[model samples]
Target chain A: MLILSRRKDETIIIDDKIEISIVDIKGDQVKLGINAPRSVKIYRKEVYLEIEKENAAAARSSDALASLGDLFKK
Target chain B: MDNDVKQISIPSGLYGFEGLTKFALTRASQEPFLLLKSLEEESLSFILIDPLYFRPDYTPDLSDEDLKEIGEEKENNLYALAIVTVRPGEDPQMTANLQGPIIINGDTLTARQCITSNPKWQTRHDILAEIRSHQGAESC
Candidate 1:
């Protein structure tokens, strides 16, 4: 991981397409403004990880879904 | 290869299963639950549920970028299916991932698991409890 120090209002450009700007800085929280192509998907690291973890757990329980058939009686 | 199988292509795939772009959507033995079987890996599959079936007010606020990626506009023939997770034991518990719903475009059959910006949604929503609560409200 390349770590670079940037103060507020500083911007980092990736591949000359994606731009990540440091919008605001409070004591601990740092707000970011990202400009990227529509194809690029942006997400918070923790939110993305949570979805990944949930997907993995859901995949593992596929066989157990048969038991749930009784719950939905329509 | 079944006639009932609907081919779905997720260019970016799911959060964890990124390499798997192709999948087959088929109805499970259950009425509402659907099976999302990976075409690349035979052993991998997931049970999907239409969140709106239980949570009638479920409206995932999809970003324009996410919609464009799937070649769709907001709510234009889009089917949002939540991945179901079943916890087995003496009393089995089931939950659905509402935070990241698998959004499929009906026309093109393209799909993507989109993460909503709403903090109210979460990875695990108690399916049975939600149903019971709905039933409890109806009786009043």
Candidate 2:
């Protein structure tokens, strides 16, 4: 990852459509503000990773369909 | 949990949105969608979604027991549905919200979105693959 240092009110531009700004820095926590188009989605890294893991797990479960079929057998 | 079978119509399409309904072409030929039908009528129109499509970071709310029942490992099932695709040429793909899921009361039919503990069910699933395989031997 490209790491950069910036003070409050500074900003980073991406793909001409998204802008990330440094809002404040308190202790170890740094507050940020993001600007992007409505169609674009932004999320935390951990959250994204968690969801990706879930998506992979769900995709692997062939039994779900089988169970649903079992539900119909009754 | 009452299973009083009723001939409820699924709007012939998902929520009757003209654009989204176009996808329902594939679903029409598929078998009756055997969902965990809600007891309430209002919660009838629901879809499961994939969390990665929306907020890749989501956690569900489920007890240890509920987790076992749904066959999940944690209290991390929750998501919402913005849109679902039911096409004729493609698989009937319904996106599930990994952040939230449509939960219905089988007895009252009153549905509410619930977070599942199961990490195995996506918000969106393609029903076409299942349908294709189920077709008669000649079609295959």
Candidate 3:
């Protein structure tokens, strides 16, 4: 892992396209501003991890489709 | 190529099952459940359900980048299916993952699991409870 110490208002450029800037810092919270192309998809780390975990659990679901079919019947 | 199965290619693949990109999508032996079976692996599969079936106003609020990734033009031929999680037990409880829905382009057969920023959407939503509540409301 690459580690660099940057202060507020400092910006880091990646691949000559994406830019990450330290927008604000107060106490334990720090705000970041990212500038990337439209093709780039960015997400909060925890949110992404939660989705990944849920997908894994969904894949392990039991073969209970037959039992649940009646629930949809009107 | 089974007559009922539709081949879908997810270039980026699902988050945890990233390597298994090719999938055979077919309706389960049920009214509203669909089975997404991975072509790369036999044991891997997911049961899907249209979120709107339970949550009538399930607007995922997909981002522009998400739409572009799936090649969605004017939102035509796009379908969003939520992955269902069915717990194993005597009385199984089922939940749907609405936060990250599998968006498929019917015309191109390309799909991607997209995450929504909406606070109302979550990874697990009780399917039975939702339906029961709706039924109670309708009866009134």
Candidate 4:
């Protein structure tokens, strides 16, 4: 992992397109501000991973989903 | 299998299936659930539902970047859907990921799965239990 120390208000540019800045730091929590192109999509690491897991589970035609056809109407 | 298949383009191509872009959004037999069938991969399909249906207070304020990503200007023009997760059993449990809501632009047919900033929302929420719990409160 590439570790770089940056103080508050310090900015890091990626590919000259996306910019990440440290907005504030207090205790163990740090607030960040990201500036990227509209084409670039950003998400929290935990939220992104959760969505990926949910999407993977939804891809298959599970017995639970398959049986849902009769569950809702009933 | 019939008509009413709306072509939706997920620019980000969702979380897991990032490669697959084109999809067909059609109504399922039930009113609450919709079928998100992928055109590229025939087997790739998912059951979708509006998270708001389960949680009326679920108001996910999309960031400006989220709106631009889907080419949507007004937030009202965007339709949101969550991929349903069902557990297999005699009394199967179904949940919706309110944390990450899929935003779609009706005019442009562009869509994006965006993470909500709301602290109240969760990745997996019990859809059936939520409805039933609300029903009891309403009757009281």
Computed on alpha carbons, the lDDT of every model, listed in order, comes to 0.89, 0.40, 0.86, 0.81
The local lDDT score (0 to 100) that residue B100 gets in candidate 3 is 94
Model 3 bad stretches (over 4 Å): A70-74, B1-3, B72-75, B136-140
Instruction: Compute the interface RMSD for each candidate structure.
Output: 2.0, 12.5, 2.0, 2.9
Interface RMSD of 4: 2.9
Error of 4 at B78 (Å): 1.4
Q: Write the per-residue lDDT of candidate 2 for residues B1-140, one digit (tens) a residue.
A: 12334332222222112122111111111233323332333323322333333334444553443223323332323222322323222332333434434332223222333334455544444443433344544385
Give the range where candidate 4 chain B is weakest over 10 consecutive residues by summed lDDT: B69-78
Better of 1 and 4 by DockQ: 1
- In model 1, the clashing pairs are none
Question: Which candidate tops DockQ?
Answer: 1
Clashes (backbone N, CA, C under 3 Å), per candidate, total: 0, 38, 0, 0
lDDT of 3 by residue, B84-122 (tens): 988867666789999999999888888999988788999
Per-residue lDDT of model 4, residues B1-140, tens digit only = 23488999987798888899999999876667888888999888888888778777777777877887789466467788888888776777678888888888888889888888777887789888888888798899
RMSD of each: 3.4, 14.5, 3.0, 4.0
How does candidate 4 score on lDDT?
Answer: 0.81
Better of 1 and 3 by TM-score: 3
Computed on C-alpha atoms, the DockQ of candidate 2 is: 0.05
lDDT of 3 at A18: 99
* Candidate 3, position B118, lDDT: 89
Q: What share of the true interface contacts does each candidate keep?
A: 0.87, 0.00, 0.79, 0.58
Off by over 4 Å in 4: A5-43, A61-64, B1-3
